[model samples]
Target chain A: MKNIKIRRLSKEKLNKPALHRPQASIESMHKYRTDMYEGMIAETVVVRGHGGTNINAYFARPLGPGPFPGVVLIHHAPGWDEWYRETTRKFAHHGYLAVSPNIYYPFGQGAPEDVAAKVRAAGGVPDDDVVGDIAESLSYLKSLPQSNGKAGLFGTCSGGRQVFLVACRTKGFDAAVDCWGGRVVMSKQELTAKYPVAPIDYTKDLSCPLLGLFGEEDQFPTPQQVEQHEQELKKYGKTYEFHMYPKAGHGFFYYDRAAYRQEQAVDGWNKLFAFFEKYLGTTD
Target chain B: MCTGIVENAKVSGSGKGPDGWYPLDQASVSYDHPDHAQSGRAIIIDFLNEAVGPKARIAVELTPESARNLVHAILASLSRGEGEGVRAKDEPPQ
Candidate 1:
């Protein structure tokens, strides 16, 4: 046998905590092991969405028989596109059964961009419809045989805002990650028929621990709005953590876009996975 | 961040789409993330005929500066056309 030297990560780097959990550490969570088996499958599947309507979703999961935590991804305002599919697979890579439903399915179908443009012209999907869809998605995850009976929510941009809304309005989600979701703290004048109430108003009803990541320069949910939201969560005594990155703006996690911030996005993703592992890890 | 700022107008015109020429009934202009534009945000314009479904449309994404230039060019061209006695006295069809 040939002698091989192995270098391990330092304790300071591996044990760093992403959030303010005194007892939890991130040691070994991100370590790579060559001996471990790894495989995943990703494809489009049909699931019952809001109002019992059949909708298409990108479903991804590891090639294993044991139970695993599930994650429902609410895609951004760009519509259900390639980025979302890749994200779904990413969650699967981390031992999560992930699904991202096409909320714009009812609007029309062609190319994702065209459908999204139509949705934009129609003034966006109604808040109620989205809530129903997410709730059903959660149910679908729980129903899967490979599920560990625990699920979390993850979303970015407009999807991020919807994550907060769904976490507040629906029940049974173990954890949630909202990445720069705008319109959560809408003003009186911003209210419309579709979005009649702000998601912050439902803080009292939040049923799961929330993790929020924001960029300091984001205009939609500006620093001030994030502060207001944090205040509300504090008042309700909710379990939550928020991190704001400097020199990054909206959609910083999108590597394909110019807004991608490598440092901040990587750090944000680490915190997100840590938070989900803490709240939605497999029970076995 | 999605600006959530959108404006709509009813219009009477013909737009060329993937299929062929279609009668346009509505036009929407919004400031939001573009699906294809390299910029983080853009001014998106969509010409559509809802009766013909989602594909019966033409879409454009422009950067802020380019959108401003387009606005200026549109006004200048309209002014030139009117000066040449091509302007219609009657109001456009609602």
Candidate 2:
């Protein structure tokens, strides 16, 4: 380690917490897989998750499946944005039951523009509450007759951060895939809002395998920061794999945004599917 | 807030497979001094925009079973050269 004394800018102004929308509409609607790669069953349902949270979840069953594997998709910080739902549908197009919950509920819901102000005014919800809601959703999936009782987790942005925290806090998930969410580390001052779990303290207790995908160009938490975090994981002896996309930025996996890079997103999607197949597949 | 984990198996380093430990890719690791490979921390600065403009990225890879192992290895290695204080204590003869 270099004995370099990196000067801390003591007079620098503290960054104001970014205002964020707390939740999205739980519109229970159904849509089919656009093009058939085959074995894709699509449907929408309202699920009572996390102490009866009204969550809009989507299920995609295998084409000829008596029963199929399941995946729980957690949405990013902007709430259940449009891209989150589309991603859920895409998971349905694949051969798994995918469920996504708008973690920012109970605070308020409205257009993206309004929710942020309301959330900030309401003092934000804790991370643990969201995690509990996700856990309840998992239990709900397990109880479903069509599901094989095995579930994996996937998330983008804030959702990505949640996946890692959940993997560390609970052993229920068979595997977890986190796409560019690294909010696991929060400072004392940053603890103004409530959180369901403490990722920093709990990361070492992680039992499940995890895969983290990051855009090399993410501005919020740079890839280097993410890599540094990975180094932290080395101390805990928890297994994880990381993929850094060369030319992608934050929300690069999102199809609706200009930031979307189809090639990179597809590559990530392929890797995600393969990872699930390896870890969540049933030999029986 | 940087928090992450890198776990590899004992034989083949992967999360899904059976238990195994990862042998650090020494070749890829950067050390302050070549002769002091195990002593100082290695750093790698990668480009942030690997896809477009080249950005800087810095990383260090090390092996220990758990967080405990990581802390011990880092502290010991920094204080002494390589495995000086890191050697397992010898058992007393019966």
Candidate 3:
């Protein structure tokens, strides 16, 4: 933390907030996977999201007819881009029907970087809107004929906090995964009027079985914050598993970024798959 | 890091953006996860024309060391009165 900084916001900044356009014209999808692996069909589509809005979303699922478990993949602070779509495919390859909605649609279809900046300027999506959108995503998954009725939610960065919030605020998710989400345990000063309550406060209401993946060195939810969250979960007798990898930080799963930690990211993915399988599938 | 709260400052004049030059009115600063910077942590400044769009601005993400240097340089330049040709009274783009 550099001590050389100042805190001052313009009145205009307070009055005219930045916004994200949660919209995108779904482009055609092609077979990005290898030929040997031909068990999934992925597509770009629109979902009936929060406020009854038609939001752009990516969907991928197995080719078979049997009902597969569903999982909603929430993107991080970064705008919904290639990685999120690929992650959706990854879930589909693992036998889960996955969908990731472009929550930035409200901010318009620009470069992902620009869209992210807009959302950040707006102080991230409102938690209530996030919950509503996630609920819509869950409903959409359940409505799919190929869905098994059981669904899980997985998110990274700020998206991770959304996963925890959805599990607590709504149902339909059989399991939840939080990947290095910062701000779950926000400081008092961090709590502003727009986002006043901390996600930790909702721990008691976290209905679904939860799995938390964390970076031990992550400053946002530092090792101390993780411990605090665990204490609350323990106090509530919640069923959960937490894995904090050493030498890892936020966005460790972002292979394209510098933070990508191969060993840690691989292990995190393994945990995610294992956790989802346990709750969303019949383990024999 | 979550980067937590972002600070905004009043600004004037224009910046060259993707859509050409646009009037920039505000600058938002924060220490957060950068969009493209390789650094795990960096101080970022977004000179924005909110009236236009998010793309209507200049954004910079600098490492702590570089940001400190930038601040010092900015202060030194300001103290040395570098505002002479900034507005340039009647000069047009050359």
Candidate 4:
């Protein structure tokens, strides 16, 4: 087997390209916000990660950068969404080289909107596999020139759970932020309960300091469950933080959805950024 | 569905210039699982011992010295065929 070459991408190659085409100026002026969504900061390219798999990732760097710290943004379950993209952009905005891998990309080759359905169609993949995919993204990010050798992990929904997993399983992540992903206890019965099943049972291996945010009113995972997860983390002696908002529900941080709670979402975002700044800022 | 038998493999070292491991460009060739070739990780020490010849100098590209551990795991999976029972080896440590 040929040893995979670990190539570091240059800063120039990581910039989002300007798309000021002829006819699109009128549409670009609309509130759809083309500038936010359309920049091609990273290519839909493949890189060799752990286990020699051709991992797919979207990488973005600071607008005009030196060697900035890096962040691996794991997407919520179902699949990647606009929120994932914005989260990556936010990391880039904060002067970090942010990379988000489409963990379900191997099964879904279409636009981001189509990923959730594709994930359902692929049946359930093991949680370790998902965590492996995250590790690959970290490897890819670390190989980038703009990565500044410092890295962290962040995620929302199921992605949040992944942040915790990567912190425990991988070495590259110096910090982690999990938004509303419960530490599930997986069992044979619980495994079959949800499609694309969640193996919440394997969280004992978490090794890094993690910060988790949850909604008190979420039906799938109640505030009590979130507290239970927090207690479990404490039992493991892992450094972690857990927050429960009284009134928010699932997808509260998602601005595009009707369930959006701007105030709570902003508070969560600020806290996450602060956590990253404190833990990863100096390390990276 | 992706499966293959190991025909051969070469061990190579991380090409981080002078800072890399000694004796670069060793490899292991495998007919099956072309994907696993990139990292050059294997599952058993003796497995690599057999493929690369005993005490054969090989180079690998990875951070830290743990790439050997990763390689042992990967090679063990390939030799087991279909990777079914092999999954247990990676089970989270209790």
Candidate 5:
């Protein structure tokens, strides 16, 4: 509850129609290219990770030679499952090389839910390890032949908190998006070995602009906590945007669950695209 | 909410698993989001055997109401069988 600067996004900013997206003229020239795949391709691979340990990750990217901006998608608490892989493809299909690494690879992959249960039993992944994994994921994306040397970070749920954590702990990321991340603001008594410190404390180290999507009804990151986050970013004069949707609760973007709110989720996605377009430096 | 807390205990006996059968050595109880429960969140119980890996286990996610009733049922069952269980224990009575 220490004091920090906070600012609510004004209606003028929130009402802004869209982000500046670079045109994709290659879509019109597919008949001339034999090197490109129809649109995009996705596959799983083992990437060198934290402590030189190899970890599994899902990589999705468009099939072209041109330099495409890179994006790293962090899987939510449910484990790296179908949605995360699909989201990676969505980014790649839209002109960015996106990768979502299996953050829980160490626990072994069985059913995503089952692996998630084991991870929960183990008290979650260590914060430092997560930061290292994301850093490596970002590096892997940057090394792609189609990479433009710029990368953005995006994630939902606990993964969203990781988006912020990695942006602050590592460098080279150009943009970041956090969707309904919980526990960014945890009390001292709540601290554990895995999450030794509140992510809010790392505000000053944030290396890139941020985009935050939240459910106004979320109790974990209640509106007050979002306010605190905004204030911290302001105190550091960090570039950022935040959207709090009405009539939405935690995990509202999860289409499979009862919390799904189509309108809000759709809008949140649009805003995310805009944010990425603006910061990832999209090009034709 | 991540809740992100776990209560652990040493457990004996076994539960049927994918591979047929396994010894259960531990149990972890947590209240958090569930993979299949219709409730927004639930109390999750994982009966596990670490030596057999993560999948060697039985798990349940119950709504708060359901969890409460389940607890009551377990207590009632235990109470009703307490005398029999106590008598069967191989111990030196003081």
Candidate 6:
């Protein structure tokens, strides 16, 4: 069997590059071979979210996977939109099962923009509800047959803040990435009935290695605020890495928006994959 | 970045939305990232009627300059209407 596998690999190499190459390292995650078979399935499915409510989620997974790490994507305050679906697929293309839950499902369904506006009007989703929903998503990912039994968290903007909150509040995640999450360091006056506690307060309970990517120009979580968060993490002796891009601002990873910064975003994504690989294990 | 700052007010008016006209009962104003505006951020205004449904709403995202212009226009129009003997009442129209 080993000799036959080697021969197949050799034959594939001679024909052209394979579409699904073995994930050897961070660099391998960026490269794709042309000749190899690559298939993925993406769709919207219902998952039990916070308070046992059945919420809609976009799920994507690679085909024919022996074992694959999982990632739960938390949508930004913009509600669940196309960018999130595309991003879920992007993670699948990289050999990981990805799921993005519509945390704003209770707000009603329509164009994402409309629903998000409704959520915003209601002062955003409660932190506890989001935490519950993400915990459920983590469970859903782990329950999959193809799962390698490891999962990571990734979120941008408000989703970023929620990822940090979830990583601190829950257990079992191997890694987490917070991309320019704002309001992590909220003032007493900024606290509302929904977000009663600052996420920074839970720093000591962080359950996994964390990677944070921030834009220096971001106003909500200013460079000073990021510094404050790092200090707290340091006080707890937590394992983490944070990168601040010089010319970028909040939501810099959003390619469809004016905030998109190509060079910084590319570097940030590379750092993200590397961090996840280090903590969650490479997709083989 | 999500500013996470929102201001709400009880408003009595009418707005045209995706489903046509509806009675608006609330207005929310904020300065944050726009859902459709091309800019990095903008002033967002949402006129909504919760009694109707979430879809019974009108939303606008405008640049700071545009928002300021809109504010000035509203004030100026109100002033002109009052000059033309449009009654100004202490309370909203019934």
The C-alpha lDDT values of all candidates are 0.84, 0.56, 0.78, 0.55, 0.81, 0.84
When sorted by DockQ, best at the front, the candidate numbers are 1, 6, 5, 3, 2, 4
TM-score for each candidate, following the candidate numbering: 0.88, 0.60, 0.85, 0.59, 0.87, 0.88
Q: Write the per-residue lDDT of candidate 2 for residues B1-94, one digit (tens) a residue.
A: 1122112212222121122322322112221111112321223111111211111111233322243466566667765875444554452433
- TM per candidate, chain B: 0.85, 0.21, 0.80, 0.23, 0.82, 0.81
Query: DockQ for each candidate?
Result: 0.50, 0.02, 0.38, 0.01, 0.45, 0.48
Per-residue C-alpha lDDT of model 3 across residues A1-284, encoded as one tens digit per residue: 11111111111132232322212111111224455545678998999778998898999988877589999988888789898999999888778899999888887777777778777776778888888888999999999888778999999988888888889889778999998788888878888765678899999999899999888668867877877787788789898887667778888899999989876776667667777878998211
In candidate 6, how many Å is residue B4 off?
A: 1.3
Q: Give residue B74's error in model 3 in angstroms.
A: 1.4
**Candidate 1 runs further than 4 Å off:** A1-28, B83-94
- Give the per-residue lDDT digits (tens) of candidate 6, residues A31-123: 567777888999999998999889999999999854999999999988799999999998998888899999999999888987898889889
Summarize candidate 4's per-residue lDDT along A1-284 as a digit string, tens digits.
02111111111121221222122222222233435632326445675544567767777776543567778888865456666777787677666778888776665354453344334323334566777788877777778765567788887766766676667666767778877664353334444322233323435766556777777666435565665566666566677766666567665787665556766676667667767777767222
Q: Candidate 3: misplaced stretches above 4 Å?
A: A1-37, A282-284, B82-94
Candidate 4 CAPRI level: incorrect
Clashing pairs in 6: A17-A35, A18-A33, A18-A36, A19-A36
Among these predicted structures, which one has the highest DockQ? 1
Candidate 4 Cα misplacement greater than 4 A, ranges: A1-43, A192-204, A282-284, B1-94
- Of candidate 5 chain A, the 10-residue stretch with the lowest lDDT total is A1-10
Better of 1 and 3 by TM-score: 1
lDDT of 1 at A28: 43
Give a tens-digit lDDT track for model 6, residues B1-94. Answer: 2788788899987898767888889998888888779876789999988877668778899998999889867767987977644434543554
Q: What TM-score would you give candidate 6 relative to the actual structure?
A: 0.88
